[model samples]
Target: MPFRINSQLAQLIEQHYPAVKTAGFHLSPVAGLTGESWRVSMSSGEMLARFHSPDRQISGADRRREHSILRHIARHNLGPCVRLYSSPWLLVDWLDGAPLAEDAFAGAAQDVLTQSLVKLHHLPLTGYRLDLQQQFAHYWQHIDRRRLTPAWLRLHKKMMRCRPPAPLRLSLVHMDIHAGNVLETPHGLRLIDWEYAADGDIALELAAMVRSNGWNAVQQHALVQRYVDAGGYRDLVLLQQQVNRWLPWVDYLMLMWFEVRWQQTGELKYCEWAQPLRP
Candidate 1:
């Protein structure tokens, strides 16, 4: 969890944050699936420097889009405060928190999770809507299909044929909302890693949360009810139906992310994760 920062990396950090020049500081690498980041500790204050991917098409992270969302979400107290957003890096106030565990996420902290999502959906819609079909197609282009297993290829074909249902309501949606992405801060639960967040169907966001976290029928139903009670949705039955339709697509996207990342980085972990997901 702790490592020394080399001179080159230290110099890079200084370029992004000049305040580190005067103050004693420490740099530790943080675990990230794709892009690299560091927890910057300084005598003055703490901050996080999130590096953006060079090939945006492959990583599917729109830093500009994320910056736009963050600028607004910070005012609403939904996310971290942005200090600077120069190309290839974003500097923000370091939030003191721990990532929620899967057990606590579903068992004890489900109410907070549900309420936070309701608050997210209430935010004004960004102009861009998250298009999963296009995203899938983009990822597929980069992956080596010739090396893909028959099962993965079959899932790809199936995803291509399946039509996603219409939106229950169009709003700002955090497309990724697993336990690891939710931070338990002193103030409250806050969502992090906004790389995939954008304007989309509320039902799609719910489906991603349920399927990724492996929520059971009862847990899923309870979430829908809580969302409705929080004034997040009107028709519970309709939203549930839409979420059901989006489940398979969520599986497809998750699998493709792993496959594409594997191809892009030659990282065996991505391949390992995909093996269990494949049919």
Candidate 2:
């Protein structure tokens, strides 16, 4: 069983953070789909602490990967997320700005986000793997080995056959680009959680953000056009075609993720969401 932080974590906090003068401190649970996250309040300001459950299905390498990526982003002058400390037990940081509001997308914030992503794409990152095809295969193999539902398996296999647009230009992508993951501050937008960061089609991030937000087709088109304009002459046809091809695989990955969550929480809703998305 994963050890839930009850009293020991609180003691650890008092021992580490100087702001917390007393061992008895205020802690509030932060809502998250996976893992235990909290807002720890001291006399001065609050810090965010995220603890990955030992029972969660994440490899040690995954944690190391994110730690390295976050350090790199910090070094590159991205101000959204500030890394205070990282260890196997905790990831601590000063709280970021408020999450972008719902309407933040329709106004100047969209343009700002687009420009930020462009800057991110242009970063001189090397030595990282950007294998979308291989990732798809990994998810599919998990589905088969675990004997997932026939519907899900069928969708996985079908999506596996679809190919990405040829002539791929690999760049560092923020794989998870949702409103919640973005903070709108006076400085600019900041991306969080480098756990999913990797080199891949930048358009995949755009597609995932649009699809997850339920943006209309018009908005999706406008978003892509804006990115293309900022990016300087991207091939729109290839972008959309590749995005369409990857959509099914994205769905498959999401469903498998939910399955893993279900195994942890025994919640039917996680599996329920996967039903409609199944091919």
Candidate 3:
């Protein structure tokens, strides 16, 4: 079984959140990959309680970083996002909906996602700070001790070598846009899991989603066209080239991210899917 919330953390929450204390908080496992998140039920409504890994070495600052990004997104009304109730442990206004599982090109889900990305790209930054190379370097430093294969090493080096494109446009990026990260709510689609959020090329957001979700050629083209139509394509060819070159990097980082999560929660599925990216 995966890790469960300790009694101490539960008490901390009850002490802090008024809603949790009055109606009393009911804790159940919230399906997530990294960090400890739970479905917290109170008299008012449902909320998500996410706990950062206490390890001093990793994920300690992740909570704060995610908090900042979510606040930025929420303030600008970037997307159908959950409201931030607390740092790391957010009390999102429960959006009753499902994950969009259709092909990336079809249905309201596609439109929701495309429009959300465009909105995010145009939103002005308040205090978002991003150092992409340093971020990946930190992950690489931690994972390098495990005897990485030669091909994987090559991918890492190449990813690092690909510098920020000149005349680079800077805007908020969700960084990770996989199927599960998006929720199809009745109000609209709300994006969850802002852990890997950052400020970078908006194209990177679309590219990451496309490559990570394994969108087919037709679906990929459709999504890209939608982005272009939404004013995301002054330099479409360059953006596509950069996105293609960065695929290995994206794959490797995602694989390692899962590997670390497995260690944290004893969740084996994270490592199971990592095999495809293995050299």
- Whole-model alpha-carbon lDDT for candidate 2: 0.63
- Model 3 agreement with the true structure over 243-272: per-residue lDDT tens digits: 665555567666666655556556568667
Every model: Cα RMSD to truth: 3.1, 3.8, 3.7
Worst 10 residues of 3 by lDDT: 52-61
- Model 2: residues with Cα > 4 Å off, grouped in runs: 1-8, 11-25, 32-35, 54-61, 75-86, 90-92, 130-147, 160-167
- lDDT over C-alpha atoms for residue 187 of model 1: 92
Q: By lDDT, is 1 or 2 better?
A: 1
Q: What is the TM-score of each candidate against the true structure?
A: 0.88, 0.78, 0.80
Among all windows of 10 consecutive residues in model 2, the one with the lowest summed lDDT is 54-63
Candidate 1's TM-score: 0.88
lDDT of each: 0.80, 0.63, 0.64
Give the Å shift of residue 127 in candidate 1.
Answer: 1.6
